[model samples]
Target: MGRSRPGPIRWLWYAVGGRLPDEYREWVLYDLTAPTWVLRHLCRAMVQHSVWLLLLLLPIPLTLRIWMVVTGVSVGLFFSLAFIEDASERRLIRQGFPVGLNRKIREESSGAQRSELAAMYAAYYTTEPDV
Candidate 1:
């Protein structure tokens, strides 16, 4: 079946932890499993934290508002990174995928690159003793 994306409004909701309709299940799978999934996750986290920007509407000094938004986003990003795997899995689950499926799919998708890296590491880091 073809992957179907949600509309912008639906996508924003999805980005902030809301569940998408079943029609976008394939797109959600692709989103969480694609090669750049981590980056995509971080982008979603940024969007989630961007509510801090609303501080700009406050009567506070411009610099203070900017700093508050920056600090809030920075802290949010840090926590997001710390819980990225769990969060990704939860998002997948919300979309009807089983738990741990994200990690399995990621591992399977990167198997070739991972094997190549292991081979390269062994070649560079292992030494043979001369007889």
Candidate 2:
């Protein structure tokens, strides 16, 4: 998917109905390619579980006083996506991607890009250090 080369606004795309904001690109890629096993699970959760945000709208119409639950979930999601992106950098640290790999990708340098298969191979070999 990343090989298709997204634009500057690569956050998401559209689907059926109104055709808006249902398909996620970068988030999906991150979830799939997360450097650590923990990060992969975490990123997947952030992308897949965002539908819970709609519960806030339900509480208002249902006369449910869910302010605390709503507020906490709101804050959690607000930080979760950004946290996942930050955590993706650990891939570089774990696989020993040379310095500035993140910058290279952000710069859209084709030469700096690794094939998805190669990345998957590296991820397969990554193991947590014994503490």
Candidate 3:
């Protein structure tokens, strides 16, 4: 969560777990390579923080308050992003997540059949200038 200020070590942990080896290099590649597990980890953190807020907030030491706040903020932000991502996925479904659909189709189709379909589409489209 952008609003949550994690300590350097925690930040590094997230970076590493997310498969972002370097902060400054190939940002897109890092994102593409990011593990879905990291998101799940964040979700777990969010839930853990909520439980802390409910069960430990009043009893924890002041020194621990910072952690509680950061975790709580991070949880809120993570859920927000999750919602946004879900919305985007739904939108992609409507407008077409072609790459995703293609992957599914490829996985389900025989290689020879897939190749034949590809060839047919290529041949048909190549002849149609409007296409």
Number of the top lDDT candidate: 1
User: Order the candidates by lDDT, highest first — what do you get?
Assistant: 1, 2, 3
Model number with the top TM-score: 1
CA deviation > 4 Å runs, candidate 2: 1-65, 91-100, 109-131
For candidate 2, lDDT tens digit of each residue in 1-131? 33233333442321101111213323333333434435544544455455555666653655453654466566765665556545445534443444444534444534335345434433433444579
TM-score attained by model 1: 0.79
Per-model TM against the reference: 0.79, 0.33, 0.23
Query: What local lDDT score does residue 90 receive in model 1, on the 0 to 100 scale?
Result: 93
Full ranking by TM-score: 1, 2, 3
Model 1 CA lDDT for position 61: 93
Model 1 worst lDDT window (10 residues): 117-126
Residue 85 of model 2, lDDT score: 46
lDDT of 1 by residue, 14-106 (tens): 999999987676677778777788899998998999899899999989999999989999999999999999898898788666677667666
Give candidate 1 misplaced runs (Cα > 4 Å).
Answer: 111-131
lDDT of each candidate versus the true structure: 0.77, 0.43, 0.41
